[model samples]
Target: TQGKEKVDDAEEVKFEIWKKNSDKNSSMLEAKHDQHGIYTAKTVIKEPGTYTVQVHVTARKMHVMPKTDLSVN
Candidate 1:
């Protein structure tokens, strides 16, 4: 027997990119999603340093935020 599953809603995904120790230079990532629930955003780094990328997701009154460090040369 197969079980039925329902997807009432989906989580909103967003990203924030900024250089380390700099708050004024932060920018929001414009992400696009496909039918497979994959989100993607494109950005260009003009400086060479350590940067932070944060992924924010919200769904059903719940929120999740994850961050990572990135370096560009």
Candidate 2:
């Protein structure tokens, strides 16, 4: 997944991934500075299951950013 963002004020942005089926777990995949906010993640799914991707943008405050769903076959 790739896109552009227009932010008024922000210090940092984070990209993360996790197994959607599992509730007690989350993984930190990548992080980027507020200025150079370009990022990518290399993830491995062990089982055939659903996964989630979230982008967290933080500056003066924090936001949930966006979410995505992935299916491993």
Candidate 3:
């Protein structure tokens, strides 16, 4: 998955990917923060199974937050 974020402040945004079916105790993928706080992460699946993709977005010292859900077949 890939995404981009636009910010007016100089603060940096962090993004991470995790599995929804799991206990939410670990991350499946993590992307490095760019200059614009945008990032991209990849998840690999070998077997035919259903898995969910979770995207978490957070900014430094900011209240603005967002999340997204994705499905993989």
Candidate 4:
């Protein structure tokens, strides 16, 4: 939410990830809650480079997408 509160009862959570500027390596996966106020999704990328990860959160009729960049090294 706009208040930055915790969403413990989300209807769905997903992660859209890809290597920057490359759609061939892109993937979208449903995230699983670890029951620790955190969600996780895993994928194997053999190549090492920079990538973008976008988190999609849906709950209580609201949806938020937050993205960030990371390096695999």
Best by lDDT: 4
User: What does candidate 2's lDDT look like per residue over 2-62, in tens digits?
Assistant: 2365554456566677778788288876564334444445667788888888878765555
Error of 4 at 63 (Å): 0.6
Off by over 4 Å in 2: 1-10, 32-38, 59-64
On TM-score, the leading prediction is 4
How good is model 3 by TM-score? Answer: 0.43
Off by over 4 Å in 4: 1-4, 23-25
> Taking the tens digit of each residue's C-alpha lDDT, what string does model 1 give over 1-73?
0124332344677788889988647888766665445577887888999999998767567777789999999
Candidate 3, 1-73: lDDT as tens digits? 1225564342333444445666665454555555454566555655453444444444444444366665556
Model 1 stretches astray by more than 4 angstroms = 1-9
RMSD (Cα, Å) for all candidates, in order, is 5.4, 4.5, 5.3, 1.9
Supply the global lDDT for candidate 3: 0.49
Worst 10 residues of 3 by lDDT: 1-10
| Residue 41 CA displacement from its true place in model 4, Å | 1.2
Give the Cα error of residue 2 in candidate 3, in Å. Answer: 20
Tell me the whole-model lDDT of each prediction, alpha carbons only. 0.73, 0.66, 0.49, 0.84
Q: Using lDDT as the measure, what is the rank order of every candidate, best first?
A: 4, 1, 2, 3
Q: What's model 1's TM-score?
A: 0.72
Alpha carbon lDDT of residue 32, candidate 4?
90
